[model samples]
Target: MSVEFSVFLIAVAFIGLVVSIIILLRKAMATLDEANKALAEAREAVRDLGSEAGSVLGHANDIAAQVKDKIRAIDAIVNSAQDVGQILHTVTDTARKAVAVLNHTPQAAQPEYVPTNKITIRKTSIDALAKETDRI
Candidate 1:
Protein backbone atom coordinates (compact mmCIF):
# COMPACT_ATOMS: atom_id res chain seq x y z
CA MET A 1 0.00 0.00 0.00
CA SER A 2 1.04 3.60 -0.38
CA VAL A 3 2.49 5.20 2.80
CA GLU A 4 0.08 8.14 2.63
CA PHE A 5 -2.91 5.87 2.44
CA SER A 6 -1.68 3.73 5.36
CA VAL A 7 -1.00 6.86 7.38
CA PHE A 8 -4.50 8.12 6.66
CA LEU A 9 -6.03 4.80 7.75
CA ILE A 10 -4.02 4.84 11.00
CA ALA A 11 -5.17 8.40 11.70
CA VAL A 12 -8.75 7.42 11.13
CA ALA A 13 -8.42 4.48 13.50
CA PHE A 14 -6.89 6.70 16.17
CA ILE A 15 -9.68 9.23 15.79
CA GLY A 16 -12.28 6.52 16.14
CA LEU A 17 -10.57 5.23 19.29
CA VAL A 18 -10.48 8.74 20.74
CA VAL A 19 -14.19 9.21 19.98
CA SER A 20 -15.01 5.92 21.67
CA ILE A 21 -13.00 6.92 24.74
CA ILE A 22 -14.79 10.29 24.89
CA ILE A 23 -18.19 8.62 24.68
CA LEU A 24 -17.26 6.20 27.49
CA LEU A 25 -15.97 9.10 29.58
CA ARG A 26 -19.25 10.96 29.11
CA LYS A 27 -21.22 7.95 30.27
CA ALA A 28 -18.92 7.58 33.27
CA MET A 29 -19.41 11.23 34.16
CA ALA A 30 -23.19 10.83 34.01
CA THR A 31 -23.00 7.82 36.32
CA LEU A 32 -20.80 9.75 38.71
CA ASP A 33 -23.30 12.64 38.74
CA GLU A 34 -26.14 10.27 39.54
CA ALA A 35 -24.08 8.73 42.32
CA ASN A 36 -23.36 12.18 43.76
CA LYS A 37 -27.04 13.07 43.72
CA ALA A 38 -27.92 9.81 45.49
CA LEU A 39 -25.25 10.42 48.07
CA ALA A 40 -26.60 13.92 48.73
CA GLU A 41 -30.10 12.57 49.23
CA ALA A 42 -28.79 9.91 51.64
CA ARG A 43 -26.91 12.56 53.57
CA GLU A 44 -30.08 14.62 53.95
CA ALA A 45 -31.99 11.56 55.13
CA VAL A 46 -29.32 10.78 57.70
CA ARG A 47 -29.46 14.34 58.99
CA ASP A 48 -33.23 14.17 59.35
CA LEU A 49 -32.95 10.86 61.20
CA GLY A 50 -30.36 12.31 63.53
CA SER A 51 -32.61 15.22 64.46
CA GLU A 52 -35.59 12.92 64.99
CA ALA A 53 -33.50 10.62 67.14
CA GLY A 54 -32.43 13.56 69.24
CA SER A 55 -36.06 14.55 69.73
CA VAL A 56 -36.98 11.00 70.73
CA LEU A 57 -34.14 10.89 73.21
CA GLY A 58 -35.28 14.13 74.74
CA HIS A 59 -38.77 12.77 75.22
CA ALA A 60 -37.41 9.58 76.75
CA ASN A 61 -35.28 11.58 79.13
CA ASP A 62 -38.27 13.63 80.18
CA ILE A 63 -40.33 10.51 80.75
CA ALA A 64 -37.53 8.97 82.78
CA ALA A 65 -37.27 12.09 84.90
CA GLN A 66 -41.00 12.06 85.55
CA VAL A 67 -40.91 8.40 86.51
CA LYS A 68 -38.07 9.05 88.90
CA ASP A 69 -40.03 11.84 90.55
CA LYS A 70 -43.06 9.62 90.90
CA ILE A 71 -40.93 6.86 92.39
CA ARG A 72 -39.48 9.32 94.88
CA ALA A 73 -42.95 10.41 95.90
CA ILE A 74 -44.03 6.80 96.31
CA ASP A 75 -40.94 6.05 98.34
CA ALA A 76 -41.75 8.93 100.69
CA ILE A 77 -45.29 7.63 101.13
CA VAL A 78 -43.99 4.12 101.80
CA ASN A 79 -41.52 5.45 104.38
CA SER A 80 -44.27 7.37 106.15
CA ALA A 81 -46.51 4.31 106.14
CA GLN A 82 -43.69 2.18 107.53
CA ASP A 83 -43.12 4.70 110.30
CA VAL A 84 -46.81 4.64 111.21
CA GLY A 85 -46.85 0.85 111.20
CA GLN A 86 -43.82 0.76 113.49
CA ILE A 87 -45.48 3.22 115.88
CA LEU A 88 -48.65 1.16 116.01
CA HIS A 89 -46.69 -2.06 116.57
CA THR A 90 -44.74 -0.46 119.42
CA VAL A 91 -47.94 0.81 121.07
CA THR A 92 -49.57 -2.60 120.79
CA ASP A 93 -46.48 -4.34 122.21
CA THR A 94 -46.39 -1.92 125.17
CA ALA A 95 -50.08 -2.52 125.92
CA ARG A 96 -49.60 -6.29 125.76
CA LYS A 97 -46.67 -6.13 128.16
CA ALA A 98 -48.65 -4.00 130.61
CA VAL A 99 -51.56 -6.47 130.50
CA ALA A 100 -49.22 -9.44 131.10
CA VAL A 101 -47.60 -7.69 134.07
CA LEU A 102 -50.98 -6.84 135.54
CA ASN A 103 -52.20 -10.40 135.16
CA HIS A 104 -49.09 -11.86 136.87
CA THR A 105 -49.20 -9.46 139.84
CA PRO A 106 -50.90 -10.64 143.05
CA GLN A 107 -54.34 -9.21 143.78
CA ALA A 108 -55.94 -8.18 147.12
CA ALA A 109 -58.48 -10.44 148.89
CA GLN A 110 -62.14 -9.71 147.98
CA PRO A 111 -64.51 -8.30 150.63
CA GLU A 112 -67.53 -10.48 151.46
CA TYR A 113 -70.94 -9.40 150.04
CA VAL A 114 -70.71 -5.54 149.95
CA PRO A 115 -73.68 -4.25 147.91
CA THR A 116 -73.43 -0.52 147.26
CA ASN A 117 -74.21 -0.38 143.50
CA LYS A 118 -77.76 0.49 142.32
CA ILE A 119 -77.54 -0.63 138.72
CA THR A 120 -77.13 -4.18 137.40
CA ILE A 121 -76.09 -5.59 133.97
CA ARG A 122 -77.61 -8.80 132.51
CA LYS A 123 -77.10 -10.81 129.26
CA THR A 124 -80.07 -12.26 127.36
CA SER A 125 -81.06 -13.43 123.89
CA ILE A 126 -82.75 -11.31 121.21
CA ASP A 127 -86.22 -12.55 122.48
CA ALA A 128 -85.56 -11.01 125.90
CA LEU A 129 -83.88 -7.99 124.30
CA ALA A 130 -87.22 -7.16 122.65
CA LYS A 131 -88.82 -6.67 126.10
CA GLU A 132 -85.77 -5.50 128.04
CA THR A 133 -83.59 -3.01 126.17
CA ASP A 134 -81.35 -2.36 129.19
CA ARG A 135 -80.16 -6.01 129.50
CA ILE A 136 -76.92 -6.71 127.64
Candidate 2:
Protein backbone atom coordinates (compact mmCIF):
# COMPACT_ATOMS: atom_id res chain seq x y z
CA MET A 1 0.00 0.00 0.00
CA SER A 2 0.93 3.64 -0.49
CA VAL A 3 2.04 5.62 2.60
CA GLU A 4 -0.61 8.32 2.03
CA PHE A 5 -3.41 5.71 1.89
CA SER A 6 -2.11 4.03 5.08
CA VAL A 7 -1.97 7.40 6.87
CA PHE A 8 -5.49 8.28 5.70
CA LEU A 9 -6.81 4.91 7.02
CA ILE A 10 -5.15 5.43 10.43
CA ALA A 11 -6.63 8.98 10.70
CA VAL A 12 -10.16 7.63 9.91
CA ALA A 13 -9.78 4.84 12.54
CA PHE A 14 -8.70 7.39 15.17
CA ILE A 15 -11.69 9.64 14.40
CA GLY A 16 -14.07 6.68 14.67
CA LEU A 17 -12.53 5.69 18.05
CA VAL A 18 -12.93 9.29 19.34
CA VAL A 19 -16.57 9.40 18.24
CA SER A 20 -17.27 6.05 19.98
CA ILE A 21 -15.66 7.29 23.17
CA ILE A 22 -17.75 10.54 23.07
CA ILE A 23 -20.98 8.51 22.63
CA LEU A 24 -20.02 6.24 25.59
CA LEU A 25 -19.24 9.29 27.74
CA ARG A 26 -22.58 10.91 26.96
CA LYS A 27 -24.41 7.69 27.84
CA ALA A 28 -22.52 7.46 31.14
CA MET A 29 -23.34 11.11 31.96
CA ALA A 30 -27.04 10.51 31.24
CA THR A 31 -27.05 7.43 33.52
CA LEU A 32 -25.31 9.40 36.26
CA ASP A 33 -27.92 12.19 36.05
CA GLU A 34 -30.74 9.62 36.35
CA ALA A 35 -29.04 8.07 39.39
CA ASN A 36 -28.71 11.53 41.02
CA LYS A 37 -32.44 12.20 40.44
CA ALA A 38 -33.35 8.81 42.02
CA LEU A 39 -31.18 9.56 45.01
CA ALA A 40 -32.87 12.92 45.53
CA GLU A 41 -36.30 11.27 45.38
CA ALA A 42 -35.21 8.65 47.92
CA ARG A 43 -33.98 11.38 50.26
CA GLU A 44 -37.31 13.19 50.01
CA ALA A 45 -39.18 9.97 50.76
CA VAL A 46 -37.05 9.41 53.86
CA ARG A 47 -37.80 12.94 55.07
CA ASP A 48 -41.52 12.34 54.73
CA LEU A 49 -41.19 9.09 56.62
CA GLY A 50 -39.32 10.87 59.37
CA SER A 51 -42.10 13.43 59.73
CA GLU A 52 -44.68 10.66 59.90
CA ALA A 53 -42.65 8.87 62.55
CA GLY A 54 -42.47 12.05 64.62
CA SER A 55 -46.25 12.42 64.48
CA VAL A 56 -46.67 8.82 65.57
CA LEU A 57 -44.31 9.38 68.45
CA GLY A 58 -46.28 12.43 69.57
CA HIS A 59 -49.48 10.43 69.56
CA ALA A 60 -47.81 7.70 71.56
CA ASN A 61 -46.71 10.26 74.11
CA ASP A 62 -50.28 11.54 74.41
CA ILE A 63 -51.52 8.00 74.95
CA ALA A 64 -48.93 7.43 77.62
CA ALA A 65 -50.04 10.61 79.41
CA GLN A 66 -53.64 9.44 79.31
CA VAL A 67 -52.63 6.09 80.77
CA LYS A 68 -50.81 7.85 83.57
CA ASP A 69 -53.91 9.91 84.38
CA LYS A 70 -56.06 6.77 84.42
CA ILE A 71 -53.63 5.11 86.79
CA ARG A 72 -53.88 8.10 89.15
CA ALA A 73 -57.67 7.93 89.02
CA ILE A 74 -57.51 4.22 89.89
CA ASP A 75 -55.29 5.04 92.85
CA ALA A 76 -57.83 7.60 94.09
CA ILE A 77 -60.61 5.04 93.76
CA VAL A 78 -58.58 2.54 95.80
CA ASN A 79 -58.05 5.15 98.54
CA SER A 80 -61.79 5.86 98.62
CA ALA A 81 -62.46 2.12 98.88
CA GLN A 82 -60.08 1.92 101.84
CA ASP A 83 -61.95 4.79 103.56
CA VAL A 84 -65.29 3.04 102.95
CA GLY A 85 -63.88 -0.20 104.42
CA GLN A 86 -62.84 1.69 107.56
CA ILE A 87 -66.30 3.25 107.96
CA LEU A 88 -67.92 -0.19 107.54
CA HIS A 89 -65.65 -1.63 110.22
CA THR A 90 -66.61 1.14 112.66
CA VAL A 91 -70.34 0.62 111.96
CA THR A 92 -70.01 -3.15 112.40
CA ASP A 93 -68.24 -2.70 115.76
CA THR A 94 -70.94 -0.33 117.06
CA ALA A 95 -73.70 -2.70 115.95
CA ARG A 96 -71.99 -5.62 117.69
CA LYS A 97 -71.69 -3.63 120.96
CA ALA A 98 -75.34 -2.59 120.84
CA VAL A 99 -76.37 -6.23 120.28
CA ALA A 100 -74.27 -7.38 123.24
CA VAL A 101 -75.81 -4.70 125.52
CA LEU A 102 -79.32 -5.68 124.46
CA ASN A 103 -78.61 -9.39 125.07
CA HIS A 104 -77.15 -8.80 128.56
CA THR A 105 -79.89 -6.42 129.78
CA PRO A 106 -82.75 -8.00 131.84
CA GLN A 107 -86.36 -7.46 130.78
CA ALA A 108 -89.11 -6.50 133.37
CA ALA A 109 -91.89 -9.07 133.80
CA GLN A 110 -94.64 -6.41 134.23
CA PRO A 111 -94.79 -3.28 132.16
CA GLU A 112 -94.93 0.03 134.12
CA TYR A 113 -97.92 2.29 133.48
CA VAL A 114 -97.44 6.07 133.40
CA PRO A 115 -100.34 8.57 133.64
CA THR A 116 -100.40 11.52 131.23
CA ASN A 117 -101.90 14.83 132.52
CA LYS A 118 -105.17 15.79 130.83
CA ILE A 119 -106.48 19.35 130.56
CA THR A 120 -110.21 19.98 129.96
CA ILE A 121 -111.07 23.56 129.11
CA ARG A 122 -113.65 25.61 127.24
CA LYS A 123 -112.97 27.14 123.82
CA THR A 124 -112.16 30.49 125.44
CA SER A 125 -109.68 28.84 127.80
CA ILE A 126 -108.12 27.00 124.84
CA ASP A 127 -107.86 30.30 122.98
CA ALA A 128 -106.13 31.89 125.99
CA LEU A 129 -103.76 28.91 126.29
CA ALA A 130 -103.00 29.11 122.57
CA LYS A 131 -102.31 32.84 122.93
CA GLU A 132 -99.99 32.29 125.88
CA THR A 133 -98.14 29.47 124.09
CA ASP A 134 -97.79 31.62 121.00
CA ARG A 135 -96.28 34.44 123.13
CA ILE A 136 -93.83 32.04 124.65
Candidate 3:
Protein backbone atom coordinates (compact mmCIF):
# COMPACT_ATOMS: atom_id res chain seq x y z
CA MET A 1 0.00 0.00 0.00
CA SER A 2 1.06 3.65 -0.36
CA VAL A 3 2.53 5.31 2.77
CA GLU A 4 -0.40 7.76 3.26
CA PHE A 5 -3.02 5.01 3.00
CA SER A 6 -1.09 2.88 5.52
CA VAL A 7 -0.91 5.83 7.99
CA PHE A 8 -4.63 6.57 7.59
CA LEU A 9 -5.62 2.90 8.26
CA ILE A 10 -3.45 2.78 11.43
CA ALA A 11 -5.06 6.01 12.70
CA VAL A 12 -8.58 4.61 12.15
CA ALA A 13 -7.78 1.40 14.02
CA PHE A 14 -6.31 3.38 16.97
CA ILE A 15 -9.44 5.57 17.22
CA GLY A 16 -11.75 2.51 17.18
CA LEU A 17 -9.76 0.86 20.03
CA VAL A 18 -10.01 4.02 22.13
CA VAL A 19 -13.78 4.23 21.63
CA SER A 20 -14.23 0.57 22.63
CA ILE A 21 -12.10 1.08 25.76
CA ILE A 22 -14.15 4.14 26.75
CA ILE A 23 -17.45 2.23 26.40
CA LEU A 24 -16.08 -0.63 28.56
CA LEU A 25 -14.89 1.85 31.18
CA ARG A 26 -18.30 3.51 31.35
CA LYS A 27 -20.07 0.13 31.91
CA ALA A 28 -17.53 -0.74 34.66
CA MET A 29 -18.25 2.58 36.41
CA ALA A 30 -22.00 1.99 36.39
CA THR A 31 -21.57 -1.52 37.89
CA LEU A 32 -19.32 -0.12 40.61
CA ASP A 33 -21.94 2.46 41.58
CA GLU A 34 -24.63 -0.19 41.97
CA ALA A 35 -22.32 -2.34 44.11
CA ASN A 36 -21.52 0.64 46.32
CA LYS A 37 -25.25 1.31 46.93
CA ALA A 38 -25.88 -2.32 47.91
CA LEU A 39 -22.96 -2.26 50.36
CA ALA A 40 -24.27 0.91 52.00
CA GLU A 41 -27.73 -0.63 52.53
CA ALA A 42 -26.21 -3.76 54.09
CA ARG A 43 -24.09 -1.66 56.43
CA GLU A 44 -27.15 0.26 57.64
CA ALA A 45 -29.10 -2.97 58.29
CA VAL A 46 -26.20 -4.41 60.31
CA ARG A 47 -25.98 -1.25 62.40
CA ASP A 48 -29.68 -1.40 63.27
CA LEU A 49 -29.46 -5.08 64.25
CA GLY A 50 -26.41 -4.41 66.43
CA SER A 51 -28.16 -1.65 68.36
CA GLU A 52 -31.23 -3.79 69.00
CA ALA A 53 -29.09 -6.71 70.10
CA GLY A 54 -27.23 -4.47 72.51
CA SER A 55 -30.50 -3.25 74.00
CA VAL A 56 -31.72 -6.82 74.52
CA LEU A 57 -28.46 -7.78 76.20
CA GLY A 58 -28.73 -4.80 78.54
CA HIS A 59 -32.25 -5.78 79.58
CA ALA A 60 -31.16 -9.36 80.21
CA ASN A 61 -28.33 -8.11 82.42
CA ASP A 62 -30.76 -6.00 84.44
CA ILE A 63 -33.08 -8.97 84.97
CA ALA A 64 -30.17 -11.13 86.10
CA ALA A 65 -29.14 -8.49 88.62
CA GLN A 66 -32.68 -8.34 90.01
CA VAL A 67 -32.80 -12.13 90.35
CA LYS A 68 -29.48 -12.05 92.24
CA ASP A 69 -30.83 -9.41 94.63
CA LYS A 70 -33.97 -11.46 95.31
CA ILE A 71 -31.93 -14.59 95.94
CA ARG A 72 -29.76 -12.74 98.47
CA ALA A 73 -32.83 -11.48 100.32
CA ILE A 74 -34.28 -15.02 100.44
CA ASP A 75 -30.99 -16.36 101.81
CA ALA A 76 -31.04 -13.83 104.65
CA ILE A 77 -34.63 -14.73 105.55
CA VAL A 78 -33.80 -18.45 105.62
CA ASN A 79 -30.82 -17.81 107.91
CA SER A 80 -32.99 -15.83 110.36
CA ALA A 81 -35.61 -18.60 110.43
CA GLN A 82 -32.90 -21.16 111.21
CA ASP A 83 -31.63 -19.00 114.09
CA VAL A 84 -35.14 -18.76 115.55
CA GLY A 85 -35.58 -22.54 115.32
CA GLN A 86 -32.26 -23.09 117.15
CA ILE A 87 -33.31 -20.76 119.96
CA LEU A 88 -36.66 -22.52 120.43
CA HIS A 89 -34.96 -25.93 120.46
CA THR A 90 -32.54 -24.79 123.18
CA VAL A 91 -35.34 -23.35 125.36
CA THR A 92 -37.45 -26.53 125.17
CA ASP A 93 -34.43 -28.70 126.08
CA THR A 94 -33.62 -26.56 129.10
CA ALA A 95 -37.19 -26.68 130.39
CA ARG A 96 -37.33 -30.51 130.08
CA LYS A 97 -34.09 -30.87 132.02
CA ALA A 98 -35.28 -28.53 134.81
CA VAL A 99 -38.53 -30.50 135.23
CA ALA A 100 -36.59 -33.78 135.63
CA VAL A 101 -34.21 -32.31 138.20
CA LEU A 102 -37.08 -30.96 140.34
CA ASN A 103 -38.93 -34.33 140.12
CA HIS A 104 -42.02 -32.37 139.04
CA THR A 105 -44.45 -34.59 137.16
CA PRO A 106 -46.89 -33.15 134.63
CA GLN A 107 -50.58 -34.10 135.12
CA ALA A 108 -52.32 -36.03 132.32
CA ALA A 109 -54.50 -33.62 130.38
CA GLN A 110 -57.95 -34.78 129.32
CA PRO A 111 -59.03 -34.01 125.78
CA GLU A 112 -62.05 -31.70 125.83
CA TYR A 113 -65.08 -32.80 123.82
CA VAL A 114 -66.60 -30.10 121.63
CA PRO A 115 -70.17 -30.88 120.49
CA THR A 116 -70.41 -30.80 116.69
CA ASN A 117 -73.41 -31.09 114.37
CA LYS A 118 -71.44 -32.93 111.67
CA ILE A 119 -72.20 -36.64 111.27
CA THR A 120 -68.55 -37.59 110.59
CA ILE A 121 -66.93 -37.20 114.02
CA ARG A 122 -63.16 -37.85 114.20
CA LYS A 123 -62.20 -40.78 116.46
CA THR A 124 -58.64 -39.53 116.97
CA SER A 125 -57.65 -36.97 119.67
CA ILE A 126 -54.46 -34.91 119.12
CA ASP A 127 -54.46 -33.15 122.55
CA ALA A 128 -52.53 -35.86 124.43
CA LEU A 129 -49.71 -36.70 121.96
CA ALA A 130 -47.30 -38.41 124.46
CA LYS A 131 -47.63 -41.47 126.78
CA GLU A 132 -48.22 -40.89 130.56
CA THR A 133 -44.97 -40.53 132.56
CA ASP A 134 -45.52 -40.91 136.41
CA ARG A 135 -48.63 -38.73 136.56
CA ILE A 136 -48.86 -36.37 139.57
Which candidate number has the best TM-score? 1
| lDDT per residue as tens, model 1, 37-79 | 9999999999999999999999999999999999999999999
TM-score of each: 0.73, 0.69, 0.63
What lDDT tens digits, residue by residue, belong to model 3 across residues 1-136?
Answer: 6899989999999999999999999999999999999999999999999999999999999999999999999999999999989877765565455434333333224434546764322222111112112121
lDDT by residue (1-136, candidate 2, tens digit) is 6999999999999999999999999999999999999999999999999999999999999999999999999999999999999877766565555444434545423423535575333464445444544543
Global Cα lDDT for candidate 1: 0.74
Lowest lDDT 10-residue stretch of candidate 1 = 119-128
Which stretches in model 3 have alpha-carbon errors above 4 Å? 103-136
Error of 1 at 66 (Å): 1.0
| Candidate 3 residue 136 C-alpha distance from true site, Å | 30
The C-alpha RMSD in Å for every predicted model, in order, reads: 11.9, 13.7, 9.5
lDDT of prediction 3: 0.70
